[model samples]
Target: MKTLWIKLLLWGYAVFSMAPLLVMLLSSFRPTADIFDDPLGLPTGPDLGNYAKAWTEASFSTYVVNSLIVVVSAVLLGAAVSLLAAYPLGRRRFAGRGLFAAYFISGMTLPAHLGVLPLFYLLESLGLIDSLLGLILVYAAGSIPFNVFVLTAFFRQLPYELDEAASLDGAGPLATFWHVMLPLVRPAIATVIVFQFVPLWNDFFYPLVLMRDESKLTLPVGLTHFFGEFQNDWGTLFAGLVMTTIPLVVLFVLATRQIVAGLTAGMNR
Candidate 1:
């Protein structure tokens, strides 16, 4: 009875969470007057005009390109740094290992919002403000803490015997890490990639504060511009939201199995 009750509760929560998404999707095809008349009502039929209008008016093309650049660059840079840094501590262990790990992990406790002024001043001095490269650096630096923490723990699980064999065959540290240890933590890498990419893709805080150019705006910021310009255009607004949301859903679906494995398997080790 208790198990069944728990299952029922979970299902109910799932429905509650999905309700808004369902409404938003329906509203995307609806007319502005219809949305106000009955916001919950279903649209008359499938209408793609909202997407076209939103795309043309919102400069979604530029936003997509900018988002892709930042997200891809950040993910690659963050993952590489995290993997290299974590491998030494997790696999090889040295003096001050614990201190180094704690130092990296400490970044998690320091919220980015608190250092906005200092970061802005520093970036301004370097002339990196309002540039996509600057945004990528910020995103990569922000991701280090969590990725290092998780990947470090995950790397600790990889068998020591593998390392022994690699070393015995005259493998150098870099080659061993590249050819051996890295592949073993693919799930963790995927998990961190998905986690970091989702937030960065939807991120508005850093973009709003750091960037001034409309041409360099990401999807989330672009949606803000769309909303500000089309305050009463519910259909187009929802369409823009739908566009922003689809990528997240697709990413989650693609990486769901790896994410589950990483979350479940890492901590226990």
Candidate 2:
């Protein structure tokens, strides 16, 4: 009876969690009037027009392109840099190593918003304001501390024998990291990529502040175009949301195993 009750509770929680996503998916096929009339009800028929309007009229195509460029570049760049920074801190004993690791990890305690004014001035001075490159740089820099913290842990957990073996095989430091150590940490890298991708894709504040051109705006900021002073287009907005959400879902599904492995890696060690 206790097992059955626990199963029932788990199933209930799952349903509760999925309800909002189901509503969003169903509403994406509906008109705004129908959504207002029955917010929880099923769509009478799939309207397909909402997606068409959102894609063509709302310029989601452009937003998606910009988001892809910025987020992907930021994730890759941040992960590479974090890996480099983490390796020595994790594997090598050097002067000020602990202090350096603490310095990188310290960034996690400070919120990015607190430094906005200084960051804005710095970017402006570099003439990078309102550019995709500027946003990419910001995202990459912001993600580094967290990525370094995680990757450092993963690197530390790796067996030192692998490094010795690589060295025995006539590999240099760079070659050993790239060829051997890097491959072993693929799961951690995937975890970092997925974690960074979601936030960078959904971030609104930075893009709104930094980007001046409509064409350069990311999906999260551009989605606000669906709102009007007097009214809002709920259907198209939900459609846009569905489009925005799908990539995240697909990515999570694909990387779920890697994420699990990465998170559990140090536990057994």
Candidate 3:
């Protein structure tokens, strides 16, 4: 009886979570009229036309390219900078070490909005305001704090014997990090990549504020253009949403094992 209730609960939760996606998928196929008539029913047959229209008519291809640029650049830069910065903080003892760590860690606690106005001015002076590079820089900076914190903890947990052994072998600090440490932290690196990249890909606010050219708009910002002042095109809007989720879903599926292993390593250790 307990097992039966547990299964029932699991099934119920699954349905609750998936029901909306199922409805959206089905709705994408049905004639808009059919949607008004019976939203819950499966498509009479696959319309597939909605996807093509959403892909071409909505200019999603360009949006996809822009989003990829922002996400990939941000994640790569964020991970590299955080890893380098965290290493010294985690491994070395030095004067003002606490203050330096606090400076980096403080960014995690402060609300981003507080910096937005100043950032806007700074970017404007640098003439970076409408550029993809500007967005990449902002995204990378915003993600650095938490990534640094995570990497710092992970680095601290690593055996210092490795560093000492490498030093005795006449390896420089850079050589030790490159040859000895980084290879072992691939799992943590994968975790940071997924965590940072997903948000950077999905972000809408920065693009809404920074991207002025429609051609330069990322997926989330471009999707908004599909909705006009007087009318809402539910079919295409949902199709755009579906398109946005595909890349993220694919990324999650491919990296699920790596992400799970890294997270679980913390528990098992």
Candidate 4:
């Protein structure tokens, strides 16, 4: 009886969580009048025109491209740099290594928004404001501490014998890292990618503050254009939202196993 009650509770929670998403999905297929008339009702038929309007009329294609470029570049660059930093901190015992590790980890505690004033001025001086490059740099730098923290744990869990074996095979440090160590951390890399990609893709604050050009605005910022002072385009806005959400859904579905593996990599150790 207890087990059955628990199962029932879980199913109820799942339905509660999924209800909004189902409403959004169904509303994307509806017209503005239909959505306002029956917000929770199903669409009479699938209206492909909402997607077309969102893609073309709303300039989501450009926003999507900008988001992809910024998020992908930041994630890859941050991962590479963090991997190099983490390996040494995790596996080596050099002078001041503990201090360096602490310094990197300290970033996790400091909120990025707290430094907005200094960062804004710094970017202005560098003439990087309103630029995709600026956004990429900010995101990449922001992600480093967390990436290093997680990857360091994974690296520490790895056996030292692997490094010794690589050295015996005449593999230099760089070669060993690239060929052997890197491959072993593939799960962690995917985990970082998924984790970093979602926030960067959805981030509206930085893009809204930094980007002045409509053509350069990311999807999150661009979606606000759907709202008017007196009214909102609920149907088309839902369509745009669906498009924004699809990528995240697909990514989680594909990388779920790898993400789990990465998170649990060092638990038994």
> Which numbered prediction scores highest in lDDT against the true structure?
2
**Which runs in model 1 stand beyond 4 Å of their true positions?**
266-269
Q: lDDT tens digits, residues 169-267, model 1?
A: 999899999999888898999999998998899898999998899999988887788789988999988988888788789988999998898888846
- Kindly provide the TM-score of model 4 when superposed on the true structure, using C-alpha atoms: 0.94
Ranking by TM-score: 4, 2, 1, 3
The C-alpha RMSD of each candidate to the native structure, in angstroms, is 1.8, 1.8, 2.3, 1.8
Candidate 4 on 145-262: residue-level lDDT in tens? 9999989988888899998999999998889889988999989999999999999999999999889999999988887765441147788888888999998999999999999999
Q: Candidate 3 on 1-269: residue-level lDDT in tens?
A: 99999999999999999888878876777666666677687787867777787788778788989998889889999999999998898888899989988998999899986788899999999999999999999999999998988888878878899999999999999998899888877778888999988877878888988879899998877767766521355566666667788888898898898888778766766
lDDT of each: 0.90, 0.91, 0.84, 0.90
Model 1 lDDT-worst window of ten: 260-269
In terms of lDDT, model 2 sits at 0.91
Arrange candidates by lDDT, descending. 2, 4, 1, 3
Q: How far out, in Å, is residue 209 in model 4?
A: 1.7
lDDT of 3: 0.84
lDDT of 2 by residue, 1-269 (tens): 99999999999999999889888899889998988888888888878998998888888889988999999999999999999999998888899999999999999999999999999999999999999999999999999999999999988988999989989999999998999889999999999999999999899999999999998999888877645411467788888889999989999999999999988887765
